[model samples]
Target: MERLHHHKVLTTVTWLLSIIISIYYTFEKPHDGVWPRRKIWHQNDKFHTAFRLNSIIASIYWIVLFVLQGGYIAHLFSGTVEHVNAACSVGSHFIVNNLFHFAFVMLFVRSYFGWAELFIILNFFNLSSLYFRHPGYARFIHTPVVSGPLAWTFIAIYWNGAIMVPHPDTLVARIFGNIFIWSILVYGLFFIVVYKDYTMGFNLSVLSAAIGVSQFLRQVVAFQWIFAFVIMAVLFVATLVVAVPAATGRDIKFARARAGDTERAPLLGEN
Candidate 1:
């Protein structure tokens, strides 16, 4: 109990510090620079085709799971027979409700923090405590987040290299742009070396690659529901024949009605 209280107090302090740092970075002068213009993967038609296809594959992957999940939910209501539909709905969940999670995570990291933020916030508390412990440690905290790697990311990603060129007319703009491009590579290398979180790291890398392609190629956003639906329809049929991962599962407690009726429930089964 005491340990839990200690953790809660420390958590509160970290959150306070993160909020302060986040606000400062938000309105502060834009120090982020842009990568120089170059041939990115998006410039090639092959890449767009691939991305579209992935989106289609991922979308179909979600849709199938959605319908199946609904049916599974219905099955769960049946006390005797627990019909399971073990399809994975992760792809759908991501592109729909979780789409905002991705954008807010990378674009405005403070809003989308998860385990990453917890680590960063803890650093904030440790540094703050350290500063208080020392008599003359205030000076170093001019940039408090620099006290740790996780917190340093806010500065590294935002202050070091920008996604867009801030000032095209200025003389130093070109210099900054060149620096920004190189800095991104350096940052990615640093992250890969330090943090081995494949899922988050891989997703961010893909996002960077996509940004590079779209920015360079001047890709326009177009609404193509029909195109997506067509791709989904095709994949749905293929899913029946192909061995794919199960989409989901659930648990429902029930009282026994008779003897010799023992059946273990599967996690991915639905109504």
Candidate 2:
């Protein structure tokens, strides 16, 4: 309960925990997969340095955003904001649920990251319950803006952070993780697009506002259960179809190299 009052604390903690989790995923190979035998972190020195510098910039960006959007967070917890009857408009309920889910998303990123259904569900009810406060611009501040790319971007750096999925060995985990990973990935793209925009204006706040219209399209207009399911299925199958052959191809190349089966030398006349 005390945690609700300190959103900044929540932000910092989430980022810090994510950083630790990333370290594990980056260096330690899991038993379930082929472990990398080389020291890869040092392989790309230039990119590594760039990543560190940009990570700092990303940190500064979040601190500034937390300050600017601090008030909207109050609406989420104040509990006194008028609550609307979701039954009146099921669409409104959908809008508010998505908004709240996305709005506090950074704070709740771990929930989605771990595929925590109860956590996500509770958050949806809590955020939507408060957001529809009878209804207006106040609601927009919740999901489309907060859960939108601009605000939800705090975790973009770790979009591939879901390392603890249902485990690849199980069919259900494979399908579930694949679909869940693919769904959240739509938001991951926001980071790349918005970061590109950052190159133009060099301003984080500007990027946030710039993302508004796009968020409206994604959150309010186009995204639906059926649409998401179709995309999820495609991504799932594509991952399997592409990954299986790719892995096999790599294995074949390694075997051929070991066997000294080099590409046939061109004949004297074929040069």
Candidate 3:
């Protein structure tokens, strides 16, 4: 019990520290002369014109989702509301971390890359703790959010690069790999526009590949593999459905159109 309290305290402190760092980076002005104007301006303009818009929308969506769904979960587990709330809080952490990452990416893609990569490593450690110390909490929290279609969207994006890498040794494998890779990359690119980083996007792709390979080995090593694959396929399709519309909405044309004719305004009183 004492150990659990200590763990919780540690996690809370880490989360607070991360939040502070994220805020600092978001508002901090770039060091003078640290970056060339062309690159920085280009990225900054892109962020202001496109990526920031998408990220704001996505963040709003997740905020609404967490409130509604999290409330429902809380009601269902009324007897263990504290436990459920804790788990839900963890899920919120996941969303917030991604949001911060997107914000960073919008400001500076290169810096975002390194920071996002470090966050992914940190998440692995976080997951380990949830998996072992609070199995029920972890299962309840992750199964619904992380293992579901929404979660898979993130996974697909992460593994996209690996899938795209050619494997001509086997035609069947090649075809499957291409499909998986393309699906992930295309979908991921959409969210990448909104989130402004490729870290979660890349990690999702990696997770997909790992799951695929694991399922394949299970088939050869055990008879129950077929059932597992079938379930995975259903979940994958569901994830596709949930993610595709959002991905399509992020297209440049769609964004520009939705943004309306603000760009047509006269520059420097030329009109």
Best by TM-score: 3
lDDT of 3 by residue, 1-271 (tens): 4654554454444444544543444455445434331232233333211011122323343344344444434433445544534544455444444444344333343434344444444544444443333322332344333322243334423322222234322456534443444454455455344433232243344344344444454235432233334433544554455445445654221121112332121111110
**What TM-score, computed on C-alpha atoms, does each candidate reach?**
0.26, 0.26, 0.34
The full ranking of all candidates by TM-score, starting with the best, is: 3, 1, 2
On lDDT, the leading prediction is 3
Residue-level lDDT of model 2, residues 1-271, one tens digit each, is: 4543344345434434533443443354333423322211221111211011123333445445444444433434444422111111222333343343343333222233343334354544544353334222222232332333232342232222322233322445434433543333353233223321111122322232322222233345432233334433443443344335435654211121112211211111110
* Residues 1-271 of candidate 1: C-alpha lDDT, one tens digit per residue: 4653443344334434433443444345223434221211111222232122232222233343334334433332334332211111111221222222223223333222233343434433443343233212111111121122222332224322232223342446534433444443444344333322122223223333433443334334422222223333333333322212222111222222233322222111222
TM-score of 2: 0.26
TM-score of 3: 0.34
Q: What local lDDT does model 1 show for residue 51?
A: 25
Off by over 4 Å in 1: 12-171, 190-200, 203-271
Which ranges of candidate 3 are over 4 A from the true structure? 23-53, 61-115, 118-140, 143-182, 185-271
Return the TM-score for candidate 1, rounded to 2 decimals: 0.26
Cα lDDT, all candidates: 0.30, 0.32, 0.38
For every candidate in turn, the CA RMSD to the true structure comes to: 18.2, 23.9, 19.1
